[model samples]
Target: MITLSRRHLIGMGAGALAASAVVGALPASAGVKGYVQSTIARMSLPEKVGQLMVQEVYGVDPTVDDSRNLSKYGTAKGVDVVRDLHLGGVIYFAWTNTYDNGPDGVAAASNALQEASLETRPKGRPDRPVGTKVAVPLLIATDQEQGIVTRFGPPATQFPGSMALGAGRSTKDARTAAAITGKELRAVGINVDFAPDADVNVNPDNPVIGVRSFSSRPDLVADMVAAQVVGYQIDGKVCASAKHFPGHGDTATDSHYGLPEITHTPEEWKALDAPPFEAAIRAGVDMIMTAHLLVPALDPSGDPASVSRPILTGVLRDQLGFDGVIVTDALDMAGVRQKYGDAEVAVRAMEAGVDLLLMSPAPLAARDAVLEAVRTGRLTEAQLDEKVARVLTMKYRRGIVERPLCEPALVDRIVGIPQHLEAADEVTDRTVTLVSNDGTLPVDVTDRRVLVCGWGATTTTAVADALARLGATTTRQTSNAPTAAQITAAVTAARSSDLVVVLTNNVATSASQVNLVKALTGSGTPVVTVAVRNPYDVAYYEANAELCTYSYSPVIAGAVARVITGRVNPQGRLPVDVPKPGGGVYLSFGDGLSY
Candidate 1:
């Protein structure tokens, strides 16, 4: 068994915070007292403080140093504070190679992390009450929001984002995918998942949560939110959080940049954005993460939702009746750090009924301030007890109390098992949407030379691979727009050939890419705009026919190919509002085709 020194623990805690200020710095080993004991017991001031600060883990460290990734274990020298400060948990930013448990190695890494922590506990703490033995286990968490926001497998299967699933208009699919996501998460030792973004995609041009959100319609969002909650919480896989409450979808700005304000009236709030949360509460979701955006209608005093009582306690708890943990968005993000000091914000969050104060820039200072507030009666000890109790309740319910040691030998079997990867492939396959089509799809180029063009035209490499598998002669070109020379070349090649297939995977960020699509439209021949991005761009082209397949993922690519070949009928519908060119939006919130 590894021995943890008092000195080692202190150093880890301090190092973890210091590392966050500057990149390439190492994080202190997380949590001091063993997970079992740390779970209970009146913690020392430093230990209590440590539990509140969680830094992002990049990868494993070899020697605790400037170049280390604090999140990965068995790599670098351990940061001392993790053992000394008695921190609560660590959020993995990226996974180490060691993190392969079954279901794409989600559980294996979790097993290894917990096993390592258990070995380092002081000799006195036993796994169980062999005549009053004490133990404390660490809580491990991940952002397994499914779809595009994953950090698990190189070949890990990905589901369409929540919005895409919503577009499919089936709660059954949402629930099943969530359950699959949970299985993968649990197999990796991740007990907490920050997921099921309940935000309705109200703003189509919203830069960030476009497809990540469910639907613009609150009712559909509510059902999908309920499905996600059920899927994760079932079969004891993991705890679920329906997040960015009040809602992140209505705002046009990204909270990652700065505090965003949602300017809805109270009536608009209850009618549109609040239904999903209400549905989540009814479903008994485990946690709720607050958004950093400022909503004047929710809290006219102008405080962000994370520190606002009206939103956190009054609306979320009292109105919606949610009594679980309320974790704030990362405090280190610009939304909070740019405005207030960590300690001040931490204390206010507690006052506002936030049970978990996460990702603080100054963990020590923030932890100390919250403790002091309680000690000085600014925040009562009773309040501290309540907050800690909620955390403990989650831990106990999740079976973190006994500090079970995952068998190290089982790690190999659990990490990246083949079945889960297949699941990812299938989920991705099923989610490809065929938004719109003109008559000219399913191109047959048996003997004809096919000319493919546009940005990410290479993404069609998968489609090309399939065509190669089927023994088709194809020529692919990489150009934003075909020049007059390029067009003449294409027409010359096509003058005697069968058909023209214009594969367009344009990036929406640049206006130039949109112009390129228009340029490619009238190139003296029949053309099809095969859109593999935001399908809204398809309107720019005057192709004889057009097809929309919203992603370039292998499974989605395969699905798109099948749809084009007439093997599969078009099934997916547009879930969020897709912008129409010339100042009109094509799709709106709540637009879906049930199958």
Candidate 2:
């Protein structure tokens, strides 16, 4: 590592600093705490405030302006995000076109952003000393939660969702999956991952956290959360985050659209919602993301956990003893913005013990608000320093300060290799739960005609291709909400086929899919229904055979195909209960059948 002294950082120009081999280098003997304290001591108010915000920019190149960039939030020009705002971190999103050309493109963009971040800015104000130019490297982060919440598309190994891993109940597989994901992320220059959603999905009707959560059982969720935290932080290459703290699993409302309330008492909260977070802390997770949820037992005030001191500081920081960084969920969400504007929301979260403000809709306004708060004694300078210190401490502990730049050429060699792909396929194969099977399975499809119908075009195409590759003569019907004509065509196609495989995504809520399944089952053909999104969909329809994959990725489709073809045995158990048409449990947790 190239070691730079304080004098060198101040004396060098922006070009010289960018060309240097190493940026923000710390001495080997200097402890992380000491380095962070020293760095914060010399920072200006603007510089210190900037270290607390992790903003988003829209582009694949740091210098170019992307059409999708929201200039009102920050700068559309990517380089300005680093130079003008001096952000502590930048988040990448597929919607912002940051992952446009895949791994190499992301790596190149990360390198450019880091170059801008490490460059020395001019000391203009009187309070800014000559030797303090703010040469800290950015903490690049992304939401690479694999299954349904993935930002990186193909060529990055697509692992199964969290509930699928929970169904398999293999901590070793969970650890291996996280290790592989962490390695690939580091290869592409991302230093932090917002993942391992530790929420316990006790409420089956929870709109957002269904398959994203590991399990309904708190003990099992704790075990999986600890394993993933250890896996992601292996070698400290990437920082793992346990999220939606205080739990978003039992709520019916989506926090993105509106605020959600959880009525669990303190006893119930500790028993049901706090285990995974406790386990994450024990496993030394680098960060914990606060949820935008209101729990009256934890804090009687109506403020959401993202802006509640009793919840964030009292419960998470003090009661749970989490000394690591505490980050908020995206500040632009309606859950936290109900009572305050962008400026007030940022200030309130900071006051409540959040160390990092993520994805503020108006990042500049938020920064200015915090600055004003500090000036007016609404928030102390010591409080701001404490938060910035936590961020820097994470950077040093995770080796982000030592290795800020990535080589684009190395990304192709490291990502989506044969080993990583095989691991993902194996994990997915182990997660295919055979809920019910009749004598119709393990069909001899060598020359048999089969009909495949599904709710999504991608799902139908993947399943059809997988079956065709296995020597079955395959025909596919794809529709989100099947029309009468579409259902009639599927029924006609099923009559000529030896067997029919229907994929359902939340069929319990979609009457059209239910009707489609009934039509196919009413025909004389043997039917196998696969609930690709949620296992609870099987209760809404009847079939000769039933299976649940808990996800809809290509890997899951291939695994389902192999399981039905008798190439792989079904080993997955249910992670959550399937409710009956009445009010009871249709299939309890841990219910599954092997071929």
Candidate 3:
């Protein structure tokens, strides 16, 4: 029996008080629900409003001596933005620590920063009870769209883009890709994955959605989006966010530079942009990130989707019945920030029913503004409570509210597992589409001299290597450099032997390889042309035969090689119409293989 004097008991009491403040002003195992209740009881009307802000991690400069982010001398000002302003969380951008191409580095950084933030309570306040820490763990989110849009490389498995998956046209294939993506994300400690872009890439001129969107057809895109939600959430337990709500598919402009407008009316909206988002919401997605584009038919104010109440609350919440967390695209992007200042954008987003104000340039300013709105009665405390409750609910569901210490060693074991790579290779095979081929393929290369040209030749060397493996002595040319003279020589050599496969991968600025395709078709050689990007290239440059590899991935490259060498039959049909030269529609979205 340990008995203590009154003075000693008082000292022990003081230590407990200190311990409570350190944890979150609650008991260690109190759980998020109990913690939220305790926290809500103590918050002032103004304090509750501050939790809605989700600001940019890079807003404050760490080098400035008196900088709000930190004082000069390596003190972390980044952590202060969340702690001092009592911000809800942060959205990582190019400035936060660079990821180690995989999830391990990201996970370590995310866990460390979030844990550090748990300390640092104003001294007098009862040490934050264990579970009731005012600074809820930071929500680690990123744009990991796999292929070209991947934020982390190397350690992270890079697969073909969403469009390539759409080209595959199998829900099972899409889900498998999503599962691998989810596992990789969890291993890295990123809880929030902003992905499965629901945007339909209907416009060929769509510079942004080129490889990001899953498909052009609404139904196909919707199905794929649903599959991604399952992969990231069900398979990995990461909170998956389906993004660019209401879609940005048909727009010609990129939102990063300016606000892109969608001219279609509300009815047309239902027909095109709404399906994938609707499916995603119905699939029980955890978070829905708003887009920056303007839909005049949906709201005539020229307001981007992030600020449109009709789009966010009226449609997504009221009509569509989505009760999940609503997050904004990065608020610092020119599409939104260039027009609306950070504070105003923050307020408007909250009013418009956005639950998370993502990556705002002025996080503290936004927090102050929301607090002021509550003080002035412009935004009620009840509204803030509702939003906080939703956020807290999500945290609870993710088991993050429990504050589990996941071992780093466990993370190392699961990343880049063999099964994931095997699945990715299989999915890649199903997506290879053959648009038009005359009998020139399946070259018995035992005696054939082959010439391969185009950006595909330069970018994906797998095509050339595949040909070599098939016993064909192949010559490769990139752009127009291995010009008429070089191409003519290769043609002369191959003319006496067998096949000439001219592979063209088009780029926005220059598909100069088109000229090479023309030369190959004109040379009176046995030519089989392959277009690895847009299918229309097949028509633009006539050849004896043609194949469309809708994407350029190592796996897709391997599948293309097998098809051309007659090892496998090309089973893909155009999901979108491959138009005539000078076609009315410049690009096709659903134009991929079905089987």
Candidate 4:
């Protein structure tokens, strides 16, 4: 056990943090829970219920997007909600929803929001009309999952996503990547990162969480999940969350669209799905995001995991012994929204043991519902206080109240620094896994005619650009769900080329990609298929050679090109098991081939 001073532990914002050697050695006062409990005791009922709501804010377009999110970072509406609603936090979406101003814009927006939250009684908390306004730092959270799910653009460091780290199989590298990510986020004025998708991708055809999950192996996933928690908490001081719990791995449906049911029994969940979350709790992950999926074995009520007390309080809290905040996946999703209205969903979610109501379609309605529930005895005051205290405890632990803003001046310098990019690139190179090969790779494009084709042509274009820089002749063709005629033309073009390299993305979601690749394979030319987003494309059809980059971004393309040209040997092993559509295993977990 590594023993450190109490000052060192608290400075890292990890005092009394679980599964830590240092925190266990500290005095009881070093823990933030004590401070938070006392603070909650002084709060009124409305103020306490207000601390449970977390809303979503957008940018640029007010009419098309959330009108309240009209502020690029914040407008009067942003301040209005903080003052009037007494909401706990706001989830920011940059490019995901509306056009957002880049780094400095985000910092300024965050600073404005924080300032509004910390303002005077009349300006800050409109609910508390009499007493002095107790300014609480709102939890500013976003999905910074790095690779395909990253919310930040340009100035933010583009770290390779979770599957990349899973391939490298280094706990130290996982910790380092998370630390770098956390530091960059802190600099940009963003604090909470919804990351490290702890779900094991046991099912390859899983549309939502394909490469986002680390691996299918429970032990390996558990190890990386723990390391990621430490990196975010001790190093980044950013609250890291393990999401879609009880696992979203095997389900074939996307929770954002509809409620997916887990077929696994309780024992199966304990053995396969629950380990990563268990490891995260032992390592002191600050938050856990509930999935909207339903598990019949856990709760026969047929409610999604987000509103099931047996799953949240019984399975997560009692069984896992996790006392951290329980955040629900966006309440606006069709899974819960289609069945229940926003207010009912919010009250039921609170009743089910969720600490924060995230991104409800009706934010004020949700807050009022919780208040009404407490007042009408639908939800006991003790129950309301339990959830609010957890939220307040996390705020204090994260030091959001003390230092909620970042210097906009340093946003440019601190974000996307060379060290962060270099580490990201290194991780990308390591995750480039060659699943199978017939000696068609290492295409010395030196004066060779190579046809690069794909659905998302950006990846193919990037590879072509890199090859052109290396003095190689290349042709590029891209489309969204190519027709049979388009596939025939691509095959004809490939037949005349020296080598054909096909890039595939989201083939699991779109079955048409399989047909296109099958058409190209019939051309009798040596075709190399690279699964850019979904790594399971190789299971359906046999390309001359198969590879996976797990992402189709800038940093990833360079690494893919290097591996094909033999500049670098791929060191990535498959993080998840590749199962065919029907039944058999296409490739077991930890399967990767080197050149």
Best-performing candidate as measured by TM-score: 2
Give the higher-lDDT candidate: 1 or 4.
4
Question: Candidate 4: which pairs clash?
Answer: 215-575
Evaluate model 1: give its lDDT. 0.62
Assess candidate 4 and give its TM-score to the true structure: 0.88
Q: Which ten residues in a row have the lowest lDDT in candidate 3?
A: 59-68
| Superposed Cα RMSD, model 3 | 7.1
Can you list the residue pairs that collide in candidate 2? none
List the candidate numbers ranked by TM-score, top first: 2, 4, 3, 1
Say which prediction, candidate 3 or candidate 4, comes out ahead on lDDT. 4
Q: Report residue 78 deviation for candidate 3 (angstroms).
A: 4.5
Q: Tell me the lDDT of candidate 4.
A: 0.78
All candidates: CA RMSD in angstroms? 8.1, 3.9, 7.1, 7.1
After TM-score superposition, what is the CA distance of residue 116 in candidate 4 from its true location, in Å?
A: 0.5
Give the TM-scores of the predictions, in the order they appear: 0.81, 0.95, 0.82, 0.88
Question: In candidate 4, residue 537 scores what lDDT?
Answer: 72
Give me the candidate number with maximum lDDT.
2
* Model 2 poorest ten-residue lDDT run: 1-10
lDDT of 2 by residue, 95-131 (tens): 7778877787888788778877777655564533344
Predicted candidate 3 versus true structure: per-residue lDDT over 1-595, tens digit per residue: 1122346424643343233244443435676677777666765554455466665444223221234344311234555444555556655544554362235555545544454444434545543322233545556677777755766554556577687777777888788887887777767656677888998777766777765787778898899999889888888777888889878888888888888888888898899988998899888899998989888887888788899999898899998899999999888778887668888888888988999888777665777788788778878878888888777677667755554223466665767667666777677767667655566665576546766666645444677778788777877655534566765665565565456777665533444566666666766777777766665566567776677766665556667677777676666545555555565653344443221
**Candidates by lDDT, descending order:** 2, 4, 3, 1
